[model samples]
Target: MDYKCTLDNADSFLNQLKLHRDRKEKVAVLSDLGGWERAEGMIREIVHKAGADYLVLDNGSALDIAKIVAVNGVFKTDCSC
Candidate 1:
């Protein structure tokens, strides 16, 4: 299942991660913000800790991100607005 979450709502995102932990689902974090390297890195660490295979698309366009996610068959988790 695809999860739409914001970095501001970290609890909800963690909950979602927990729910999928057993399934060993792949997680993809997409962000268009150019100045949030620290925030992005934090989320990446969280995803790593969750033991989920992840892909990060930093400062990418919608179409490019979509294509990559589709090809990867990963669960898209938006962590940025």
Candidate 2:
């Protein structure tokens, strides 16, 4: 899904991605990472540590969409998405 998120806050954005993943929805974050390189790294790290799946895209990259597959024992699903 095309999700719009800002780099002003890393924690909040990561939480949103987790919420989507909990619902078995693959996330493709859309943003301009040209100058927000620091935020980009933080967000990637956060998603990686969560053991969730995600794809970060700027604008020109070719899209490779995939369904969010369920992991055996990832984060518990308590999100109200």
Candidate 3:
């Protein structure tokens, strides 16, 4: 699903994460190591609070990221497209 980052979509994103958790599915937050640097701590807290995993793509490629997503179930991030 295409998720646009905006205040309106924040709640929806959190809800989606919660839903994934409720289903016993693995939910994660995938980001570049410095993608959300300023808010890294807060982001991790929020994701973990919602029972999701937080991952940083330090030097990983797109394929690596895809592999993680494929194995992890679902991910919610600030990425917009």
Candidate 4:
């Protein structure tokens, strides 16, 4: 189901600075994934650029930083990777 994420109802608050998560070792790229398979492409880009591991979970899922990673990579991650 399509979801509308706003500041009030966000899984994790994206600070006014738009700091959704710690940009130091993790990066959350909020975007549209036509499908989980399709979204992996974006995940890889994030991983490559951020030089950090990633996770992809349902946007509506809880804010469990421990469970975020790419969803489409061959790494067999739950997100998309």
Model 2: CA > 4 A from native: 1-11, 35-81
Model 1 C-alpha RMSD vs. true structure (Å) is: 11.2
Question: Residue 39, candidate 1: how far off, in angstroms?
Answer: 12
C-alpha root-mean-square deviation, each candidate: 11.2, 13.1, 10.7, 13.2
CA lDDT of each candidate? 0.32, 0.31, 0.33, 0.27
Model 2: per-residue Cα lDDT at residue 79: 20
Candidate 2 residue pairs that clash: none
- Candidate 3 per-residue C-alpha lDDT over 1-81 given as tens digits, one digit per residue, 9 for 90 to 100: 954434332333444434554565443444335342111111112233234443322233121222121123233343432
**Which of candidates 3 and 4 reaches a greater TM-score?**
3
Whole-model lDDT, model 1: 0.32
**Poorly placed runs, candidate 1 (over 4 Å):** 1-11, 31-81
Q: Estimate each model's TM-score.
A: 0.28, 0.29, 0.29, 0.18
Candidate 1 residue 46 Cα shift, in angstroms, is 6.0
Prediction 4 global C-alpha lDDT: 0.27
Tens-digit lDDT string for candidate 2 (5-60): 22323123445554554565544333333321111111222223244444443323
Which one is best on lDDT? 3
- Would you give me the overall lDDT of model 3? 0.33
